[model samples]
Target: MYIDGALTDGQGRIDVINPATEDSVATVAAAGFADVERALAAARDAFPGWAATPIAERQRWMRRLRDEVIANEDDLRACVHHEMGKPWAQTEEDWDRVVASLDFYAEEIARLQDFSLPDRAGTHSHRMVWEPAGVAVAFLAWNFPLLNLAFKLGPAMAAGCPIIIRPSNETPISAYAIGELCAGIGLPRGVVQVLATETYAAADALSASTIPAVLTMIGSTETGKHVIRTGATSIKKYAMELGGNAPVLVFDDADLDLAADVVCGVKFSNAGQICVSPNRVYVQRSVLQAFTDRAVARARAARVGFDRDDDITTGPLINARAFDRIKGLVDRAVAEGATLLAGGDRPQGMNRGHFLAPTVLGDVTETMDVYRDETFGPIVSIIPFDTEDDLLRQANDCGQGGLTAYVFTRDLARAEGYAAALRYGEVQINGVKYDIDLPHGGIGYAGVGHDCSYLALHDYLVLKRITRARDTTLFESVNA
Candidate 1:
């Protein structure tokens, strides 16, 4: 752990255990309030110099970090795989995405350059300069550990702000690797810190202090709400990427084969642990039987186990709590008369790990608990909708709004209509994928903040508007 510009040990250490083998992977210092205080002091001390660093110089460091990340691709992949049990392919893809985002910031660095607005009706021109908010506390979730960090840290680095990152207890190796890489590239002293711990002492301390100018977190909605309440007193700038209950719609005319394949990948990837994974599938009644049959077959064909050897479709749930929640949802849905189309039981072979079979449910009604809650596992519920309006209502009825809705329709007009009707951050038409340049977020309960593209940049920045008189002499004449 890096505290007060020094690498120091905490009062105690926490063992990071692999959920797959139930073995200790590594031990990390579980920092105390004292350690947190020291980190905050370092952040406060480093702020002025970091904020004053040239944006160009900051951009250069980010570029170097980006190159380092790409060069050490295999190392990152291995870490994410064993730590989070994520598939090797997905981990590599995540590394690619991180590099792409860094490239995006580097290519768009000019946006941070101070500029003078064209004089329209004023003798004095308007000026705009992007300033570092100060210190930023990045709270990362266990899933997609490094990817979430990139979302917060990339922009902060570009803006020349120091960063303190708290990686989740479940997965911290890759994040720690990132920290070490940054240090090797010589991130200014106190500019960035990464700590792995069971207790959120580091983050809690930063939230309660004045050193953190901005706080960015990626976690559950519950956690996001907690941060909001705690960070209220300090009145620091905050950004969040919380949980999501995304939905996939298969219209009557959709190609069942294509829809089944794409949706299988999206819903079960990362063991259905992703915030944007499509949790609920609405199949039009006209093709419901065919769709369910194909989807179930595809799912059954999906391999389940460790990501290391089996290029499996799914892996273990993050922990016992995640598995319990998933099982609870399944129980609730079955009691409410929902049919288990496939995969209701746990895998027969696995007994030690927190593994869950890829599950698919049918005859699921909107009133059922499975339809109303986010399972956050390799569990998906299928509901049948009769009409366009009905499906739209079913999709948008949940309190959570940070959903990613998908519509599979060959008809362009139908696709357009469904896309327009869904209240989500990003809607995919005919099973298309999300582009990094697109604005992503949800309406209502999904999330309050947006990520990706220039729209995301707005959250990390504050704009200042200056107005001036066309002529100073004219203003004096008016007074005279």
Candidate 2:
């Protein structure tokens, strides 16, 4: 753990284990308020000089940090495999996201330096300048720990703000390793720190700080709301990338095979623990049967096993808690009129790990439990829609508007209409690659639009309009 430019011991420690094999990976110190205060004070003290540093110099350190990540790619891959239980094959892509995030910050730093503000026609001259806030308190979940961390930390660093991160206890090794690399890159002693803990002690203290500015959190919708309320005292800026139930819309004109293939890839990528993973899939009636059959076959073909095992498509849920929630959701959905098309049981022969068989359900309705909630697992619900208009209506019907709807269609007009009507922050059309540069947040219950766009850099920085009179003498005479 790090506090005030140094490593400090916490009151308690917790052991990190691989959920797949129950092997002891590492241990991290779980700190309290005292530790958080030290880090806060250091960040507060360093804020001015950091924000004052020239943009070129700041960008230099950011690029170095990126190089450090590239250097340690292998180490990061192995750590992610053991701690997160993601397939070994996926680790490389995960690492690429981290690198891409750093690269994004590098470009942003240059753009920030060159960006000019709109000038008022006459009178006083003005320039828009972005300045860093004091300290950012970042909390990461277990899934895609590094990838999610990069989304916040990259901009925070580019804006010259110090950050204090609390990675999930279940999957902290890769984050810990990345922290070490960041330190090696020399991000100003206290620029970026990580506290791997069991409880939310560090976050609690950081939220309650007296510092005028703080950016709090990355977690569930409930947790994000809690942080917002607690941070009201300091009136800190809140940047939350909370929970999402991203919907996948398969229209009648869609390529069934393509939709089925992409759906499986999206859902099972992180064992379906991703907040943005497709949770509720709505397929048009014309291709519903063929799509369901193909989806079921593809889901069944996914190789499920230990994370370390080669050629595995998916792994166990983060822990027993997630497994329980997923199981409960599946059970209740089946009871509420959803029929299991292919899988709905625990994976056979995996008695030791938290393994779940990839499940697909048919005849699902909007009223079903699975359709109404975000199931962070391999279980997917397929609902049939009669028309594209109806599909769009139902897709955006939920009170929770947090979604990244996937529309598969060759018809440009249909795709354009859905894209215009769909209320998600990001929409994937016909095998589009997910670009990190694009904005990737949600509306309503999903989140408050945090970290999907190039404009996200503004979240970590405050703008000032500096002004100068055309004539100092005239201004002085009027003021005096």
Candidate 3:
């Protein structure tokens, strides 16, 4: 972990294993209780000066950090690839997001100026000002660590909040890589640091320390709950992007080929580890079989491998635990009478790492485990529905609020109706889109807070109201 512009050991160390090969890649030092406190203390020490920095200077640093990440893109890409088994191309896209975020926030800082409120009378005035919330911490999930870091880091820094990021032990190297980049840009010591904690005990202790006035995290819903429950003592504000069972609706009139190709491609991308990957596919009963056939063909044709082979469409799961967890979902779904239309086993002839075939389960029901829970792997549950009302009920019945809904329909009315009715943070009709401009966050259990937009900076800002009494002379005269 990088703390105060230096690399130091903490409680102990852990081996970062290559998920694809299940071989040790690196040994990363962990931040113990004392070390975490020192890191937090350093951030606290640096916060006032950094918060006082003019926005232009802050933006200059942001741009420099962005450029540093871009220049070291290859090294970062290799770290992400080796750490998480993501294909090189996918890692490149992640780095693209890293650069895009810095550029986006650096440009946006000048636009978020402090302002004064209207005065009620000539004697009284009110001014509204935004100030940094001191220190902040972001807990990252391993799947897209770099992108998630950008999600929190850019906005927090842009808002003038010093940050301490705790990367997932599963993929900790990339966080160190980012910390080193910030150091290269000559960011004030402790303004940005990475806490590579090896144990849940250490991470929980650090987050619960009350030093960080603002907290942000991107991870599973259960994990988010734990963060909230444990970190409640400080009463610090939180921004979280938790678990998602992204639902896709394929209306009967939709183009079957386009819908099938995109749905299958997305569900299997990154082995379906993406929080917003379309998980439940509800097809109109009339075209269910046709769509299922097309989707099954797409799934069956997907290749799983170790590298970015032109033929590969999916990669290995993060680790053995992920592989087994997803495998159990498939097995239980099958045992409960769901038809395995395409894949339910490992790819043939190769069996070493955490690889699973792209799978499609047909005739799935709302009662199945696969339907009720997040698989978080290369699997999709397809259920046929005849009525729009029934489909809507099924779509909206997710236990939690963190969902992304997709609608594929040619009719304008149908599209608009579904768009308005879907209970998810983001809705995509006909095409998929995510960028720095749109606000992305969960509504209910998906967790609090948002990412990527100017709104993100609001999370790190503390609003202050300044009131001026200009008519003091009238009161003084009356008193005399």
lDDT of 2 by residue, 1-480 (tens): 766555657877879888777678778777676776677788788788877888788778888878888988889888888886778887777687778877888677668653345557766677777678667778787788787778877887788887887888887777777777766666687788887654675566677676737665567888888777777777677777777777888877788888888888878777888777888888878888999999899888988886455678888887878788888878887888788876676777788667778889898887777887878899878988876556667788756666577888789988888889888767889764666788767777667746745777877887777877667799789899
Q: List lDDT for all candidates, in order.
A: 0.77, 0.77, 0.86
The number of the candidate with the highest lDDT is 3
Better structure of 2 and 3 per lDDT: 3
Q: How close is candidate 2 to the true structure, as a TM-score?
A: 0.93
Q: In candidate 1, what are the lDDT values of residues 116-175, reduced to their tens digit?
A: 788865567687866667788878898887777777666666666778888888887888
| Regions more than 4 Å wrong, model 2 | 113-121, 307-310, 472-480
lDDT of 2 at 142: 77
lDDT for model 1, on a 0 to 1 scale?
0.77
- In candidate 3, position 470 carries an lDDT of 78
Residue 274 of model 3 has an lDDT of 90
Candidate 3 residue lDDT tens string, 1-480: 789867677778978988888999999888888888889899999998999999999998898898899899889888888898887777876777788888898888779877877775666778888899879988999998788888888888788898999999899898889987877777888888998876788888767888889888999899989988888878798989888888889988999998988788788888899988888999999999999999999988887877756557788899999899899999999999899988788889767889889999998888888888888898979988888767787888887585688899899899999889888888889878788878888779887878888888888988899887877887799899
Ranking of predictions according to TM-score: 3, 2, 1
